[model samples]
Target: MRYGLAWCMSTFGGPIGQALGLTLAEGAYAPVAWMLLGACWIAALVSFLDGRRRRRLLASQTGLGSLRAVDWRQFEMLVSEAFRRQGYTVRETGLDGSDGGIDLILQRDGATTLVQCKQWRSQLVDVRLVREMYGLLVHHQADAVKIVAIGNYTADARRFVHGKPIELICGDALLAMVRESQAAGTVSKQTRRRA
Candidate 1:
């Protein structure tokens, strides 16, 4: 249960009521004063109840652990789409245990890039995955190796890719880029509409 929004609304309601009451008190006749106060209270009550109900519904739909596990294949598709938008020809290699840790092989501008997709829950990606991809890149003579973790990354994992040409896309960063792309499309539509 997330009560933070409810708590803030309750806390702020007191000061808001006081300010509104004081303002209304200074105004006109008895009927108008009563009506204004009643309307304010009703609006506040409706808003609070609506917020509570919405929160409850959202919580029920998406439980606390809902974000923990995501399908790796779906994530692979998302990454492929992301790369495609960047003008790369992406290929899904499935699980190649012998081919090292390469899960996706991408080609662009005659340069081949190896990508490993890890769809984890709250687990932090460690340095070992990075090392494995680095070995695969060298073995396959790939121009670049990318390790995209669809979750958080450990400090060591970040440090491991710091100097290397390896790219790391955490869950939040990936989502942000997707949002940016969506927003760009929306803006383009609006511009065309204005024209």
Candidate 2:
């Protein structure tokens, strides 16, 4: 379950609570049912609004300058959305509190890829960070590891993944991906409208 969904469930008790409340609605319990139903509605609205906000953020990323303006969590969401557009099933790991774990897990054609997103506007990703990502790839037995950043990577970081199953996407390269994904989304929407 996603972190947001889990939190919603804990706070609102979700559809199950709504159903139970409805079934038990009587002279004394009617108010409780209405309250539970209202809570569920609020949770659903919040989830929908959040998803819309993330989509808007991804669509507005036109360049490295725009990318740099996003927060770390938004950066992760943007990367995840880009990969999803490329046909990967993306799962956000919700590790925003710490910088030590994988931020997204991508699966396509039975191969898994771990993604680490860095919203470092002024800091270049160094070889040490690339090495740590490589270690995580090996530890998780994943097919590949991708580190996406708003800035660039050090030359040593680029060299470390020369022949490895690690990809360092940063700066212009990352911007290109976001652009391609955005173009693809637009084309698909147009196609759907035509049909």
Candidate 3:
């Protein structure tokens, strides 16, 4: 969605601008450089602002630790940002509504984890979803799998992940993790400044 576009624009902006600078002019190095620099700066700045805005929204909305108050898309982004704060590189695979299999893929310390976010409101997430994600682990080559549910899971679903590599973060646990991740990020920033 917008996140993917923003990331792509930010990531390619610098290099593409530089390339344009060389191709657009023959000897006008000064003008080209200025324009390219401006382009690159604007792209990077917009991306930074968007990411900061999303992160701030994530923290502020989760302050109450209530998941039902947020919209479905926001929940997914919130989950993504929470993991990002926890020092995991998170990538959103698909767009907003059509997230084929996994919503997020996380990597940290050379370990990869696939995450499927379910905004089931008050409904109990079924075992079928969990089993589908488990099947995708090998296909995605992930070290583990996690299911993030805004609501609770079915009894059968809970039993399914027992002794399995799949970790289910129910509503309560998900909120706690978000709070913990944000707190960890705060402490990390403070420690860096003190050092």
Candidate 4:
């Protein structure tokens, strides 16, 4: 998915670019040659600009909230839009007790995924949320359970997801998905309707 691609690009590409800069600095090529070579890097800049433009288009269409005014329901809607943009058939159930701990159910390629959204602004998510989601996965017989915390997770919470069937998506990860979905030009119809 584009979200995964963007994460990989930012993580790996940063180090690669730094190494390339070091290599260029130590090379036999003169300053003039380096300057000429630097001009070729304009392509990368253009690509980045194009991506930014596409993200702006998506933001315009989705009408996402800024950090200053994001509400819980809006955060949930954003998560739903993110999944839908990734080609999943998403069904949001809101805060219902029947679904156990699952907040949203998504289906794609015959696989059912349960999602839990936490829209905390300051508090760190704890392990209880992860454990509850694991139990809900069993109750729902879902293929996977994803816990999306719109804030940082505590150390224990992160450890709980490691080596478990449940996946933890932190605030940064969710934001990255939204940004990537925007860049990919895959805004969800739900978002458009809400707008």
**Which candidate number would show the highest TM-score if scored against the true structure?**
3
- By TM-score, rank the candidates, best first: 3, 2, 4, 1
Against the hidden true structure, what lDDT does model 4 obtain? 0.71
Which of candidates 2 and 3 reaches a greater TM-score? Answer: 3
Tell me the whole-model lDDT of each prediction, alpha carbons only.
Answer: 0.66, 0.83, 0.79, 0.71
Query: What are the clashing pairs of model 2?
Result: none
lDDT of 3 by residue, 92-159 (tens): 87446777788899999999999988878768889999899989997877899999987888899989
lDDT of 3 at 149: 86
Give residue 174's lDDT in candidate 1 (0 to 100).
66
After the best TM-score superposition of candidate 1, give how far the Cα of residue 47 lies from its true spot, in angstroms. 48
Report model 1's TM-score to 2 decimal places: 0.56
Residue-level lDDT for 159 in candidate 2: 88
Tens-digit per-residue lDDT, 68-118, candidate 4: 156666566667767877899988898444545667999999999999888
Best by lDDT: 2
Best of the two (1, 4) by lDDT: 4
Off by over 4 Å in 2: 1-44
Tens digit of per-residue lDDT, candidate 1, span 1-195: 124333443457598755545544454236664777899999999979854543333223222143234356555655655565566887778643453467789999999999887778768888888888888888888899887775877888788888788989876766665455445445756999999
Best-to-worst order by lDDT is: 2, 3, 4, 1
- What's the count of clashing pairs in each model shown? 0, 0, 0, 0
